[model samples]
Target: MSVRIGFIGVGGIAQSHLSGLLTLPEAEIVALCDISRQQVEKAVERFNKEAVGKEPAGRKLEAAIYDDYRQMLRREKLEAVFICLPPFVHGEVEEAVIEASLPFLVEKPVALSLSLAGKILDGVLKKELITTVGYQLRCGSFMDKARAALAGKTVAAIVANRFGRTPGVSWYHRQDKSGGQLVEQATHQVDMLRYLVGEVDTVYAAAATRINNKDNPEYDIFDSNCMTMTFACGAVGNFGNGTMAHVGVPPGLNGVHIFGDNVQVTIGGNLRIATPDGVTEEPLDKDMMVRQDSAFLKAVAENDPTLIRSDYLSGVRTLAVTLAGEKSARTGQPVKVADLLAAEAPAAL
Candidate 1:
């Protein structure tokens, strides 16, 4: 039997997963929910258009649509769910999903704050639900090569940067809704740092909202931000990001550069490594999302949580690091990731 699936949000990220699911024969999305009725209709139309000429040509593409996720969850019999909502719209929906006892795949920056993310993580663990986070960089071939190149080398310092234009979505610019660029956009790089380096111990950040989009008052997120991190392994990381530049323009580089004793690895447009002998470079494959989606579906289908690369707990840690960075930026003091996570644990949860 095919794994019945439901989507809690129909947004751009949801399209990526929807496109991925179209390629998988074992998964069928039967229910969709979003606050916008137009978005829900558009999602249904897009899915049907893509599914029409596929192998399952006769399969029904029409799905029940609801403006509220709770109604969808209560009415649909789903084996798995995809929580694709914004960072601010997290807590209650996740609790409801856990209550339903269905495996779920959530997009990253799990919540706006570490306390809320920790609360969600506690529920996920208590219920032992299968979960996957949308940190696709962990599933990339570039990461695999980078890991192999740094196997025996002692990484000393890491540098990560992201230069991009503001998101088209208005909510992304609001720090309360999207958790700023560090927590929302550059999270992939932070998670990549944790995945490639080690867990972050402390974060010190400096940020400013210099470039004001006078037209939009909701644009309160920082335009330029610099963060310094100390890893548990004693490695230091210099990570910074800016929303003042275009994403694909010149001087806009986004990726991690790892430096070891006598070796250096750069992962951006491509994966490159330099040693005493020579430099090796390979174009990075662009199928990480496909691999990510495949893994989550397989985990849900086979009842194997091990298939997922970045699960809920790991995502929560990444979220904590970003939240700490945000706090550091606001307070002008270094914040410890461990302390943030420890303070978030509720006695009952």
Candidate 2:
């Protein structure tokens, strides 16, 4: 009854997903696909070596490596796939997955552009597939407590700041490929805002590239961006994203602050949820990928879309919000998420 899982894109994020899948008893990583043959071979070899003392009899870790994901999909009896490909390539792969009628878990920034995102959403709804997007912050206990404590009370405002070093990948620096800081990285915070509050209706933003120019000439993508958002429920949010943090800062050292009528939650190096009653500091567990993977597997087994928290449709909306912010930054005007999606129809793709 174990679900056969195939991993596409053996990049850093893919490795995190792979590590988590290895711990789940209801699932097994049956195949690996990547554009780089050497990386695929290395992944297979590493998994085999690591399996020596862990895999069950006749169930030793074995994965077929492939250079093309379509070939892997065609050849394997895969129950699900975890796509960790770059943002620009996400739409087509997701379209194919939808066509195949298989459950999939796609990494964040769902698509590079709004038009492509809409097309992916159309395909997903047409196929009626179960999907989960990689917005793991929603799975955190601290985030849950924040949501609960802030309930019933009107949110006055929300402020979130994320500062970290640039990713090592060259494509990550190019706005054309990754959609800049807001779409590529800060989409998580945007989605979290929607989850904790409500859907966003309008966005005004400003962005600039302040660093990593030497290594990236096409890095027109923002190294820093700040956005002001108005939610459908009339609440307002302010968010800042940047790659300005020194290399020495821990990955989670980035900051997020949520303010409500009675509660203010501040989470950064550690999880802290506070209200007028008292303050509680909980150490954030660094196992979001594992939690996300387990949740996706359970959804797949049960064939329940509701169980998949961040399904493809919701992922598309979040992507639209982030992309609208990007457009707002570029145009120096506030952008409506609905209008942005309409203007960039699928024909542009």
Q: For residues 173-207, could you state the per-residue lDDT of candidate 1 as single tens digits?
A: 88888989999989999999888887999999999
> What is the TM-score of each predicted model, taking all chains together?
0.94, 0.92
**Where does the lowest 10-residue lDDT sum fall in candidate 2?**
340-349
Query: lDDT per residue, candidate 2, 200-269, as tens digits?
Result: 8899999887676657677677888899999887888889888766565556546667787778777676
Candidate closest to the true structure, highest lDDT: 1
The 10 consecutive residues of candidate 1 with the worst lDDT sum are 53-62
Clashing pairs in 1: none
What lDDT score is found at residue 106 in candidate 1? Answer: 95
lDDT of 1: 0.86
Tell me the lDDT of model 2 at 254: 62
Backbone clashes, each candidate: 0, 0
